[model samples]
Every structure is written in structure tokens, then in C-alpha cells.
Target: MHKLDTKLIQLCKKGNEVAQMQVYDKYAQAMFTIACRYLINEEDAKDAMQEGFLKAFVNMDSYKPDATFGAWLKRIIINQCLDVLKKRKIEFSNDEVENLKVVDDDNWDFDNSISKQNILNAIEQLNEKHKIVVQLYLVEGYDHEEISEILEIPIKTSRTHLRRGKLKLQELLKVKYNEARY
Candidate 1:
């Protein structure tokens, strides 16, 4: 059952603790999933979620009810995850990236045998830039234009990192499979 966003916003604005908890409970699972999509590790996702909630609660006054509460929270969580990734300083730059293409290779399929957890684990192995690009492009369904604005990177750089990151992710998955068989 979904609670009305307007009600949640009203209650939150009043500094009601119950309202805050209600908001958290309502969106916690989805928010955690969103965080995981970016961070790719359960622990990191958990951390991002907690930190995001803290930030959201502290700045609850800034929330204009015009937008859904969940959307507001999602933005904070995503930004928090990106900040942590930046602290790690994972590089994502190359002149050769100009030539990397990212056509829809829909043929690349992961059988059900490859668990979602396995795929996410493999993604976590990526550098921060690649991880961010892949999450924004493939997972969140953002285009290069939107991605450029979000990550503040050039559009070309975003596409290059995404393509390169995808190729590397596939290689990681294959290596994991081989190791599992050993």
C-alpha cells in the first residue's frame, strides 16, 4: 500500500518523528535498491541509504512538496553514493575512449544461472567512473545528455566510460564463472 506523497510531505514538514519513520519505511527498500544500483555492494548501499536518510531528514524543510518525497530522497541518495565513489578516486579517462562504440548488443545475455547477486558483485569490481556511468546509463536509463548533467562529465566521456565499463563487466562475469568451476 502506497501512502500519499502529499501527506508524507505535510507530516515531515511538521517535524513529526512518526512521519519521518513512515517516510523511511515506505521508501527504504526501494531507496536501498537504488543505492545498490550505484554502489553495487550491499554494505555500501546500506551506508548510502542511512546517510541519505540523515541528510534528507536534516534538510526536510527544503523539500518542496511539489515533487514526490521519494524523488527528493532518491536524488540525495544518488548524490551521496557518488560522493563516496569520488573519494575512492577511481579513474575514467582515455583519449582512445573517443572511438569506443556502445551499440545495443542485446545478444549478450546472462542465463538465470548467473544470479543477480553475482552480476552486482562483478559490477562492484569496476572503477568509480565506470560504475557511475554504467549505473546511470544501463540501470537508471539515463541518456548521455542527462548523464553529463548529473555527473558533470562531458557527454562523450560518459558514453566512452559506459561502453568500456560494460566490456570490462562482461569479462569480470566470465572470469567469475571460470573461477567458480575451479
Candidate 2:
């Protein structure tokens, strides 16, 4: 953390409203974008971001300097978005994956023709559980252990979802690739 950021966080911990606003201003837009990834509705995204900020403020004492402040806030925003999804009854499966043959393919190398936007759109087509796992792993750069902790699922379940989601995403992109070639 920068000296200035550390000072600002200390002020925030002391309940300084101006410092809090400054911190919120610095991170709100980026946090809102993060929330939007999990929430399709702009209103829901905004709500999640605001609620996340509130949670951070309430839990300001727990804000350690182990990670950058933005990363910490991002985690809070993601958790808030997931809480909203849980309220909507989105089931994150806790199924045992002992028998599932999960391929450990870290190869996300899509064809040259597949635009990043195209891949993102295909991710949206995934089932809720798989989509969340894929986004956390691929987009947010979380390892399966971190993902499992965040989603409260087993490490195997996270890998299984990522594998299944990756396969489905490839299948979707292949159709697009074929259409474009025709």
C-alpha cells in the first residue's frame, strides 16, 4: 500500500467521513464493474457495489495490509454480489466429484478468430454455478483453493465446474467459428 493509501485507511478506520468518501470514490467504479460481471441488471449491480462499500466500512477494522486495498474491496464486492445471487436462490452445488474425471487443462488458448468479447459472451451462456467458477478462475485469476473458499465448495468441485464450463465455452465458440468460416 502507498503511504497515502495507508493514511487514508487509518482515517477511514477512525470514522472520518471525508476519507471514507475519498476511498469510496477511488474504488466505486471499478468495484461496480466487478459486480456487473456476476449481475446482469445494472440496478442490482449498483446495489451490490453500494452494499459492499457499506460492508467494508462496517468491517474496516478487519482491513489488513496483507493485500492492496483495492483487492480487498474487490473481494467484498464479489461476496456481496454472490450474496444477492444466493438470495435469488441460485444453487451452488456441493456435489462430491470423487468419481468425476476432471481434466486439468489450463490451456485457455482459443483460436485466433475468437474475440475476447466472443469468449465473454459464451461464458454468459454457462449455467450459474459453472459461470461463477469460470469467471473467478479465468477472469479474476483465482486458484481453485481460493475459489473454493470464496464459493464454499470443495476444491474438486471448483475444478469440475471449470472443466465443464471450459468445455461448454469451447463448444459454443466452435459453432461461432464454423459460422464465421462459412
Best by TM-score: 2
Candidate 2 least-lDDT 10 residues: 96-105
Model 2 lDDT tens row, 89-164 = 8877757677888686578999999999999999999999899999999999999999889888788888988988
Model 1 lDDT vs. the true structure? 0.79
The weakest ten consecutive residues by lDDT in model 1 span 99-108
TM-score of each: 0.72, 0.92
Residue 104, model 1: lDDT of 67
Estimate the Cα RMSD of every predicted model relative to the unseen true structure: 3.7, 1.6
lDDT of 1 by residue, 45-95 (tens): 899899999899889889876766777788899888888876777555655
Q: After superposition, how far is residue 161 of candidate 2 from its true place, in Å?
A: 1.3
| Decoy 1 TM-score against native | 0.72
